[model samples]
Target chain A: MDTAGATRILAVVTPDSGLVGPGGAPVFMAHSQEEQERLALLLARIMGGVPHDLENGVYIVVKHS
Target chain B: MQNHVLTILLGVVAGTLARLVMLRSDYRHYPSYPHGFVTHISLGFIAALVGAVAVPALAKPDYVAATFLILAAQQFREIRNMERETLARIEQTKLVQRGSDYIEGIAGVFEARNYLVIITALATSGANHLWGWPVALGVAVISLVISHLLMQGECVGDIADVVPGKVHFDRSLLMVGDVVIMNVGLPAFREKVLEEGRGVVLKPRDDDARLTLDSIGQRQAILHDISVILGTKIDEKEMEFMPLAKKNADTGEIGIFLLPNEPDLECLVEIIKKVPVIESSKARPLSSYYGRRAAD
Candidate 1:
């Protein structure tokens, strides 16, 4: 009955930085704080991922493992 | 001979009655089924039997009977272990789990209650042997009250102030009052939560309360209690809809957001107030003088 999804750091997206998988699934970087949030929200919807705001310019989207 | 028999009978009946009166299946539902009840009651009867016989056995110089009490104590400890295992197993299937601390607390209570039954029975029998039935009855009543007091523990209201809060969203972020729970990507899910969700703010009264509420286990217990009483909107597959309690780093206030079936704000507040503070999570750093000075 655990409510939390078993999630982990899948990818990290920052304002100026991004990461990529061996499969070339790029973690898209955002230009601004607002853009980061907006992209996070959009990517979350498309990817069915959980968007977590680091409260900085960075946002991480995690998917259920 | 008649006095000896009456003493044991009075003690056993008193002990059994004490166990029955104290046994309650509350929101946590420890003794959930009929079998659970049967197991506890059977154990209570055995505890009473052992307690009732101890005094007479000693008087008869039958030292062997005294060893039975030790054996019963071991049995009760095993009961505690059994309870913990059963609850941990059941917890796996719960939507809002009773954390390990809460489970341990409950198992400990069950074990302690059995010991209390033994004490009540033995004391009642001893009183009967010394001063007859009238004094035994008085002792029984006193034991009942003692057991009642022992069972009563501190509730969330004792430590915090529960007030109704609002569940809202600013863009993708889901905010319970002023606290940001998390960023929601799906507009549809965000819309659904905003439409159906309820929120509560737990304001800690002091440092101790803040520390207690800060425990992840205590927060989970609050969520579990609210979810159990009001019925959660989400099922096992829908983890996104599950209730969450988040603490504001600056204010030390906790915001709880959940999509409940009832959605009655007043009822939710009352349930939060009544949630028992888990014994293991209770912290009293403020009690020591050095802790007070360190706060500066």
Candidate 2:
């Protein structure tokens, strides 16, 4: 059973500007680090993905396939 | 004709008995429904019948009837395919899936056991045809014992040292004793995992064991077995609590981190030790001269 789901970046929540550029995934801009974390968590829950931190005031919700 | 009847009866009984003894339904193993038991036992009986009749048919100079045993070979091959298909289909629904290597190993075991039954029946009936019932009975017992011994697959305990390891977070990354399993940004998930997760490290005994542990399928099997026994916290929707067994490439040590429903580290170690070494992943690097030469 080879079920490697297509990994897609569902949403990117970032407080810092210029760190993330818009491409395949939609980016959600946040005023603070706490907001960014909160948005990532909410998106992960709703979309059934995992929230991963990029360590530069940025968090991304990735739906692992 | 009377002698052949007696021989076939004894052989089929012995073969069916062997299958019954081996058909154990455990917590981590297959589902042993009544239907499953019936299917396997019937197959065993047929295999035994074919084996038992072969000797008598050859002795009676009925070559065509004897050639029917050759068709049994083709029938037994379908059993392997059947097991593989069933298991592979079941794998899709599992949260902590049994890896392909594990599936292949199990399917192969099923096929091999049928062959063992055939051999037991063949040997027993042959003994009866050549000597007497007393010798045939002894031969059946001996072959069954050999089959039982062969069924004992090698486990992690045989080739590694299993020990409890600390589950901690290196910033956002979840680390089980320096081997980073996965990264998490959700504070909710991080807190739950840190509070409830247990970690165990497997240090390979030697190079061969190291290579075996390196296989991704083997690692998945370890995780799947542990999750099955201990009960995983992860659900279909939530991937955050998914268990992972990550390897430390430098030292050939594996760090397994799982959020068990019951947080018993001791039992976790015991289960880790008992996890069967996946047959396909078992690489014997030290056995070859070139492999030995390469190993420093």
Candidate 3:
């Protein structure tokens, strides 16, 4: 299967902070750090790997060659 | 002092009989679990009471004292059995995740300490004739409180370990994923993409297809889509699910990703069997993998 066009997106959602993306996407709700880590890991394993460096509690998508 | 001895002895007998009855009646319900030393302590109290009342020799204060010792010994035996049962259950319900280890450890420590406390209380109660009743009662109450605290600590620690730490998916998650994959993704893939031989891979409005592929790649895309919809993490590194495993696309070598207890693979095979070309290959045994490690 050609996966070259696939993009990786990481979004951290917690109870305190709703959803935060890597690129300063508006936070949806407040969440805890634990919740954020849980969401991030869930996203990463689901996608098989994290494509981009997630910082400030947001998911980043990476394009494959 | 003699009357007090008789009262304490009667309490012991009552407690012991009650314990025996409790164990006999309820042991089956928790065949895999243990009720702990408290049950045995109760039984000791019952047995002492029975000894004091029913046995003529035990009517005297000295005999009452002897009865308490005998009952305490019996309680110790029951406690030992309870520990064995608890350990067996722990082994049976082995946690397969990283953070769950702390839970098992904490449970072990609490159980061991609780047993020690019960034993100490029983010994103290049996050894002292003048103030055995009050001392035994006090010890029992204190021990129960400590046990409760230990249980509370274990619960809090387990929650902490599970909530904030890295999510490690285990067999239960795989089973859940298998259900979701079969129910949602399988039908969607079969009707929209496989049967039609082409379909647009939907992307979130902001995210591009290229970036998705780079992060998760092709094989992983299926997993990602499934996870996105189902909302769970795959933590078991050894776990894998393959939809097709006929032969290597390039070298024609047989691929083996399906492991023991991989129900997802079975579901995929069932789907593939509907296709004429794919069904021609020999079917693999899947049920043989079930409970492969259960005894261990």
* Model 2 chain B lDDT-worst window of ten: B23-32
Predictions' DockQ, in order: 0.18, 0.73, 0.02
Cα deviation at B82, candidate 3, in Å, is 5.8
Worst 10 residues of 1 chain A by lDDT: A17-26
For model 3 the local lDDT of residue B204 reads 16
Q: Is candidate 2 or candidate 3 better by TM-score?
A: 2
Per-residue alpha-carbon lDDT of model 2 for B1-296, expressed as tens digits? 89988888888877877777777878766846888878898898888887788788888989998887878656898888988999999899999999899999988988888888888888888899899899999999998999899999899989999999999999899999978889988777789888999999999998999999999989998999889889998888788889898889789899999999989999999998998998999999999999999987
Q: For model 1, which pairs clash?
A: A1-B94
TM-score of model 3 (CA atoms):
0.26
Q: Pick the candidate with the highest lDDT.
A: 2
Off by over 4 Å in 2: A1-4
- Classify candidate 3 by CAPRI docking class: incorrect
Q: What is candidate 1's CA lDDT for residue B75?
A: 81
> Which CAPRI tier for candidate 1?
incorrect
Alpha-carbon lDDT of model 2: 0.88
Query: In candidate 3, what are the lDDT values of residues B1-296, reduced to their tens digit?
Result: 57545444534433343333333223122222354445544444544344334333343536666666566545544444554456455644322211123223323433344344434334333433435466645544554454445433211111111111111123212112112111111122123222212111112111121122222122232232223222232234312232212222232222212221223433333322221111111122232354334313
**Better candidate by lDDT, 2 or 3:** 2
lDDT tens per residue, model 3, A1-65: 76465542334344444344345322334266555545544554565543232334443322221
Give the better candidate number (1 or 3) by TM-score: 1
